[model samples]
Target: MRTHFIAIGGAAMHNLALALHEKGYNVTGSDDAIFEPSKSRLQAKGLLPAEMGWFPEKITKDIDAIILGMHAKADNPELLKAQELGLTIYSYPEFLYEQSKNKTRVVIGGSHGKTTITSMILHVMHYHNVEVDYMVGAQLEGFDTMVRLTEDADFIVLEGDEYLSSPTDRRPKFHLYQPNIALISGIAWDHINVFPTYENYVEQFEIFISKITNGGILVYNENDPEVKRIAETAANPIRKIPYHTPEYSVENGTTLLETPEGPMPIEVFGAHNLNNLAGAKWICQNMGIDEADFYEAIATFKGASKRLEKIAESSKNVAYKDFAHSPSKVAATTKAVKEQYPDRTLIACLELHTYSSLNAEFLRQYEGALDNADVAVVFYSPDAVKIKQLEEVTYEQIAKAFNREDLIIYTNPVEFKDYLFNLKPDSNGMALLLMSSGNYGGLNFDEVKKLV
Candidate 1:
């Protein structure tokens, strides 16, 4: 197949391009701008565009398909030319569905925990030497690319994100994957820019459930009232399996799970992670992995990148960076760290970077989210709000929204770094968690590590 991609330097887009290229397809792509990691990865694969900008001339009659990325505007010249040529164009999710139509698609979906669950499934499958094509959101330890497609693979694991498919395709990405087996971890309203209202945001997941094929299976978190309601009300002809926080105990900074293989210690800790593991285990069971095998394989699993990832640690201090932007994720991460180190003083810092988290109305949802932290700090860039075209937020507004009078807030990165450096490491063991979807404006982790 000959494929061309418009705005292909995106995280998922670049991975898809590489997957297609590796699948023996003649792949080419163009983007107006490409950033690090994506650029380097594409270059390494010889899939990077010769130049950075789109060219209408690149869309030719021989191109079999054009995969569109969310980053592309509707008026992109390459996209216009592809349309003019009457060539098949697909959003990233649409193309994925097309590629995996013959396979049993297992899509893991939720506002959060989707990546971790998907990664766990992939990790277990790899450990068992189960060959399957997959597409996960994060870079796993052994995976070459986030996406993999093959002609003979009978199964495909997809991290089902509820975000928009593309600028032109208004549908949520998860709705495109008509999974035979699906999982929804939890529901919390997000992507305020697209959904606008909480009700509107939830309707997307409902649509996702409806899209599942007949006789499909849905494994959802029973603890979340919203998810439970949706799973129960869905009229689709499918099996609904509800899971919750698994049986586990934390002792001496270690979490062990009670499984058929007896008690097994796992590197990843936290109630949310345990919940994710249970969901992954059920999905694996459906795929023919026994409880004992799942437990044995999962015991060796570390974690997905940036999800409570330990960056630096010492006797006195431990530092972690997490991709936690939503209120639920922030709360879960904070509580997890505190539970793991009950005697430690937890100093948590969260960055309000996502569109939903930056919204004035959504900010209130963060009330008591960071209450688990002994000292909580919130950071937001004024420039970020301006870039998002959101209502200006003041430190007082955030402080009031969180309902924590003692909360520390920073609008400047340098000052935040200065404050961190000035604090002496607690003698009684302290945990420092820096949570955000984005790096805190290029804050130097190595420098922070040295200071702490």
Candidate 2:
């Protein structure tokens, strides 16, 4: 089949292009610009466009389908051409549903820990040599691509994002997947640009729960009142199973599971991750993985990329870079690190990166998020605010919002890095947790790790 992608240079879109290309489909795509990794990977597969930007001439009746990425605008030229041609258009998630309609879909969805939960399930499946089609948001170890689709696989595991499907398709991406088995790790308000209000944001999950196939199973985090309510009030008559953090203890900064088999050392740490593992376990169990087998496989499942990922560590000091920006995420991550190393003096640094985070009104949501840390800092660029076309956010305003008078804020990445580098060696234990969805103004992680 001939498939063309609009805004295909996106991380997920490029992966989809590559997956289709590998599956022997004729894949073509266009993007105004492409970044590294996606660019290189697409180039390696000879799928990179000879020239950048849209060419409506490329659209023709011969193409079987047009896949749209979220990065493109509603009036994108190629999209206009595809609509004009009356070609069958699919959002990435829509295409995924089309491919897996015959298969048992297992979708993992939530504001936080969905990627980790999905990754955990895949890890167990991979460990047992189970061949299942899968899609995850992060670059996981032992997986070549973020997305995989196959003709013969009877099961497909998907990390179902709550983000919009595409510019033209306003529905949440997860809404497209009518999963036979679904899991929600937790819920926190995000994507303020799309949903706008907290109530509107919550209604998306309600819609997702309702979208489950009849008699489907729902594994949810009972700890999250929102998720609990959704699962309880779900209109669909589905088998509802709730999970919370499993019994686990931290030993020397490593999380050890309290299992019937005895205390099992696990590669991943954090209460939120333990909670994620619990949700993943229920999903895997429903998919036919026994409790013993799941426990064995998860022990070696270190972590998903950028979810409290260890950048550098020593006996005295350690550093972690996490994809945490939301108020809930910030608080959860801060507490997780502090709890893991009770003796360590936690120094939490966050970059106000996303649109919601950079908003003046949204700033107040961060109250008490950094209270777990011994030292707290919030970094945001004036240039970034201008680039995102947001009103100016001041350090004083941020401090007031967070309700921390001692909080240090930075407007420059260099000065921020220098401050981090020049920190006096604390006599007591110390842990540095850097959190953001965006890179701290192109700060080199490797150099920062080395500095740590």
Candidate 3:
């Protein structure tokens, strides 16, 4: 197969490019700008464009397909050329569906915990030596690429993102999967730029539930009221399985699960993670994995990258970074840290970076999200607002929105860094949680590690 990619420098796009290149297909891609990691990885695999900008010549009649990334606009030069030539164009998710149509597709979707749920399923499958094709959002420890596809694998696990598939493809990415087994972790209104209303944002998930293949299974978190309502109303022929936080206890900062095999200790903690594990367990059971096997495999499952990932730790203090920008995620993450280390002085910092998080109307949903923290800090970049073409939000507006009168808010990255450095490490125990979808204005983890 000969495939061309437009806007191939994206995280998922580059990974897919490399995956196809490894499969011995002729792969070519173009992007205006390529950053580190994606740039180096693509170059190492000989998939990086020789030049930066798109070229009409790159799109040809012989190319079997064009995989379009979300980064590319509808008027992208290569995309226009492909359309002009009448070449087959596939959004990233659409192409993934096309490839795995014959396989038993398992899609994990929700506003939160999608990566963790997908990771757990993948970890268990790997532990049992189950051969499967997969596409997860984060880079796992044992997986070379975030995406994997093979002709022989009978199952495909997909991290079902609810975001728009591409600039031209308005449908949510998860809608195209047509899953035989689907899971919705929870529903929280997000992506304000696309679905402006809360009801509109939620309608996307309803569409996803309706799209499940006939007689398929739907495993969802029953704890989320919105998710419960959706599951109850779903008209599909799928078996509905609802899961909640399993039996677990935390002792001296260690979380242990009460499995049938015995009390199984795990490296990851938090009620949210425990809940994610429950959803994953049901999915694994559907895949023919027993409870004992799931427990054994999950014992070693740490977590997905940047989802409450531990960056640095010492006897005195521990620091974590997470890609949690939404209100529900922020509250859950903050509450988790406090629960895990009850004695610790929890300092939680969140970056209002995403479109929803930055929107004035959406910001009100964050009320009391950081209440569990002993000290709460919110950071936002004025320049980021300009870049996203959003309305400017002041520190007072954020503090008022969060309903935390004493909340410390910063618009400057250096000032925020200074505040973090000044936090005295509590001797008994202290936990620092940094949450954001984007790096807090180039705050280096390496530097933060040393400071913490």
Candidate 4:
């Protein structure tokens, strides 16, 4: 089959293109801007566009399907051309559903922990040599691509994001998957530009629960009241399973799981991860993995990239970067690092990058989010606010919202980096948590290492 992608250089889009290409389908794609990794990987596959930007002439009717990435605007010229010919145009999730219709689909969804849970299941599957097709948001250690679609794989694991599908679709991506089995870890209001209110944001998950196939299975975090409510009231007659945080203990800076088999030492730590671990276990168990096999595989799991990734470390100082801009995520990550190293001083820095986090109203949600850290810093770029076309927010506004008068806030990236570099931490009692969905004003990891 012949397939074309519009705005194909996205993390998910490029992976899907590669997946289709590996399956021997004739694939072509175009994007206005293609960044690193995606550009190089596509070039390596000989699948990179001859030139950047769209060409209306490339949208011929002979192409079997056009998969649209969220990166492309609704008025994109190639999209217009495709529509002119009455060719099928599908949002990323819609296309995924078309490909995996015959497979047993397991979709993991929520405001947080979806990526880690999905990665854990994938890791266990890979360890046990369980063959399945999958798509996860974050890059995993062994996985070559985030997406894998094949004819023979009977199961497909999907990280079901609640973000909008495409400019035209105007629906949450997860709603399109219609999973035979599903999981919603929790919900918190996000994407203030698109979903203006908490009620509006939560309605998407409700819709997701309603779309599950009849008699399908749903494994949820029983500890999360929102998830428990959604699972209980699902319109579909789903077989429900509830999971809580597993019994675990941190001893001498290493976290060990108290399992029925015995205490098993693990590379990954923290309460949020442990909660995700429990959910992953239930999902894996439903997919035919025995408890023994699951426990054996989970011991080696390091975690998904950038959830709480340690980028630089020395005896005196260590620093981590996390994709944690949302209020709940920021709070969870901050608390986790503090718990992991109780003896060390935790210095947590967060960036207000995403639409929701930057909003004036949403800033108040962050009250006490970083209270676990001994010293907390918040960074944001006014240039980024301009780029996202959101209203400008003031330092006073942020301070008032967070209700943290002692908080240090920086609008410039260079000054922020310099301040951190000059600190010259050699106390052996300090750890730094730099959290953001965007680069800290493009402050690279190389500069971060000099802190020690």
Off by over 4 Å in 1: none
Give the per-residue lDDT digits (tens) of candidate 2, residues 1-452: 99999988999999999999989999999999999999999999999999999999999999999999988888998889889989999999999999999999999999999989999999999999999999999999999899998898889999999998888788999999999999988888888888899999999999999999999999999999999998898878899999988898888777888889898999888788889988988999998999999999998998999999999987788899999999998999999999888888899999999999998988899999999999999999999899989899987889899998889999998899898888764787679999998888888888866655
Query: Scored by CA lDDT, what does every candidate get?
Result: 0.91, 0.91, 0.92, 0.90
Residue pairs with colliding backbones in model 3 are: none
lDDT of 4 by residue, 302-390 (tens): 99999889888776567888998888888999999999988888889898988888777788999999889888899999988888787
Residue-level lDDT tens digits of model 1 in 299-401: 9999999988998888778888899989999999999999998888899999999888888888999999999999999989999999999899887789999
**What does candidate 3 score in Cα RMSD to the true structure?**
1.0
Cα RMSD, model 4: 1.1
Q: Which ten residues in a row have the lowest lDDT in candidate 1?
A: 443-452
Model 2 clashing-pair count: 0
Model 4: lDDT of residue 18? 97
Ranking by lDDT: 3, 1, 2, 4
Better of 1 and 4 by lDDT: 1
The segments of candidate 3 whose C-alpha lies over 4 angstroms from its true place after superposition are none
- Residues 1-452, candidate 3: write the lDDT tens digits: 99999999999998888888887889998999999899999989878789999899868899999999998988998899999999999999999999999999999999999999999999999989998899999999888999998889999999999999998989999999999999999999888888988999999999999999999999999999999999988987889999999999998889999887667799889999999999999999999999889998999999999999999998878899999989999999999999998888999999999888888888899999999999899999999888988888877789799998789898999998888888887677789999999888989888878855
